[model samples]
Target: MNVAVEGRIEKRHISLSAKAKAYVALTKPRVIELLLVTTAPVMILAQNGIPDLWLVVATLVGGALSAGSAGAFNCYIDRDIDRVMKRTQGRPLVTGELTDREALVFAWVIGVASIVWLAIFANFLAAALSLVAILLYVFLYTVWLKRRTSQNIVWGGIAGCMPVLIGWAAVTHSLSWTPFILFGVVFLWTPPHYWPLSMKYRDEYKAANVPMLAVVRGRAVVGLQTILYAWATVACSLLLIPVAPMGIVYSVVALASGAWFIYETHRLYNRAIHGHEVKPMRVFHASISYLTLVFLAVAIDPLLPF
Candidate 1:
């Protein structure tokens, strides 16, 4: 009887773990990290070069809520395609962990809550931007572009770029060129950052009938585009030094890291030439590091003092 009781407890533990995974899936943690990276640097650059405590707390929470809602809605819309892709097969919608109605209601609640939180605690501009981000990601990217064109990632990148501008406006309550430049940094960074990973999973995207660049344009073309975008990202990063609070430390790191990122993309290009497939994964990993470090340099430049 003791052994039977222990087995039942273990079964309950497993059940709880599965439920927890579904809840976390609603948040889309990797996407949230990228959004925060974009948002935080702008917050650092706002007004006094240090974020207000209340504003920071409200923006983070509101941003997370909006991002989570977008992710959940995407899951709902892509349930069929998601089940076809191995990478997304385990998601709550695909795995039967949550009902469609349940996920829909959860997404709506989160979306409404995010806008209300931002309007009440932050400002109306931030709240409006948050709502716009959600609609752009859900309606523009997921509904209109994902299945139609290989340029989906390129255009969908706009939704991803919204957080930086939202962060800047949250404190100052208006838009400016500074945030526009930061948006450009993220906008240009998205294609190269996502394309190599798409190449690495081309078969999966093809299976899902998603018109990724790797599927429609071929890996060679995708590699070349990745390199071009990496170069553009570096150029954009350099432009920030003159406009924002960034300084020599950011410039130095941007040059070194950007060079390394370009080198990785070139390696990917060369590998694709020989019909080899593994180097794009390396390029993908490097892109993540490059973006994170560049933004970190931006966030800390005021403290560095040239």
Candidate 2:
């Protein structure tokens, strides 16, 4: 009896440790960081300088909850496919760190709580938009598109793009052509941003049967699409200068960074056509830096001047 009890205690400790790691995985912290980056610029741009403290706090909390909830729900829904993918095989659901019913409950709890918090603290518009984003990501992107087509990221990008609009509406309580343009920029940026990462894991994606672009069209087609979308993203970024209150400093940054983006995409495309694989990964990593700096520039444009 003593030996059995000791073994049980050891098993319980191991189980708990695994469960903690799974919970952290469910949060998808890197994706959340990109989402927050998208939100901050809108918050900064909404006001000429910095937004109100209360609004920023509310938006951040609400956005984090919604984004985290979406990620949890995605993990729950994709557990089977996740187990097949090397990158996601250790996720909470896939590893049995959490049960399906438990994850469902967790997701809904966070989702409803986030919506309520946003509605109560932020404007109803922001709250509604957040709900729409949640629905788009969960239903349209995850349920409908992910398995059906390689263009999954294209439409799914809409869900991620909403943080900008939500942040803008949180401050202004209204939408504008400028926010829409920001949405377009992010919408176009998403494909190139994701495809390189997808290319890196194409074999994993194929084994998992996820139908990513890299899996469907092969590396050459994916590379071409990345280049095409990168060009569109750069154009959209440039369009913001006139409509957005940004000035020449922004133009200079956009021009230099945009050119680099295109150059990287071209390099990737050339490599892909030649049956090489590493350049896309380089372009993929470069894209994160490109967007982060671009949005940061937007947030700080007031101080930079024309």
Q: List the global CA lDDT of all models.
A: 0.87, 0.86
Clashes of each: 0, 0
lDDT of 1 by residue, 1-306 (tens): 012474563322336687678867966878998798878777887754678888898998999999999998999998899889998888887766777887898889999999999999999999999999999999999999999999999998889999998899899999988889879988999999999989878999999999999998877899999999999999998888888757887888899999999999999888887887556778888988998888788778876555
Q: What TM-scores do the predictions have?
A: 0.92, 0.93
Which pairs, if any, clash in model 1?
none
Which residue pairs clash in candidate 2? none
For residue 70, model 1's alpha carbon misses the true position, in angstroms, by: 0.7
Give the residue spans of candidate 1 off by over 4 A: 1-17
Candidate 2 lDDT (Cα, 0 to 1): 0.86
Question: How high a TM-score does candidate 2 get?
Answer: 0.93
